[model samples]
Target: MPTAVYAGTPVTVTEEGFYLDPDQWREDMAPEIARDAGIDVLTDRHWQVIMHMRKEFAGKGTGPTVRALGRTSGVSIKELYLLFPKGPAKLAARIAGIPKPRGCI
Candidate 1:
């Protein structure tokens, strides 16, 4: 385990960079995670996905996958890639302060 400062708070993280304890996450940390993931800005649409992911994670214990997100997030798959490019599910989970989707690499 390792600790890193995010949104001015020190939090534990795994070697993969996912937070060790989701309970310690703050909404303010989203921007920093987004920046690190190469997103310059988190628009309303981004917030839409991030919020949805967080909601799902709370109930499901794991976030949605790319296909699941496409079907349920009100955002299309192609747009999801454009919005959270490279790896939409992975990046969105990171920014949403949730564990990485079970099947995401």
Candidate 2:
């Protein structure tokens, strides 16, 4: 079955795209989505870090630095890099179900 639903209905498609239904997205769904995006194992700690980064971004109008994200999530910078090899803005925004970062558009 498709993961994305539209208007409270599941969408069927065979094309490659990023057409997700925000209402169908859940914090617990991040790992599978991330893995589908080529990410490896996503732990609960990863969710904590990513969600924190999202909240910080929403509150500050900007993404957090790795060091700051680490400090907030109580994880190390090295670990952050290990989890989000493409960087926080890329991985975190995707996990948070937020629009792609400004420069990415």
Identify the leading candidate in terms of lDDT: 1
lDDT for each of the candidates?
0.90, 0.61
Q: How close to the true structure is residue 4 of candidate 1, measured as C-alpha lDDT?
A: 77
Candidate 2 residue lDDT tens string, 1-105: 234533354533223323233334466666665776678887787778767766776687555666667677777878887877767655666666554444422
Which is the leading candidate under TM-score?
1
- Which 10 successive residues of model 2 have the least lDDT summed? 11-20
Backbone steric clashes in candidate 1, count: 0
In order of listing, the candidates' clash counts read 0, 0
Write out the backbone clash pairs for model 2: none
lDDT of 2 at 88: 61
Give the runs in model 2 whose Cα sits over 4 Å from its true position.
1-24, 101-105
Question: TM-scores for all candidates?
Answer: 0.94, 0.60
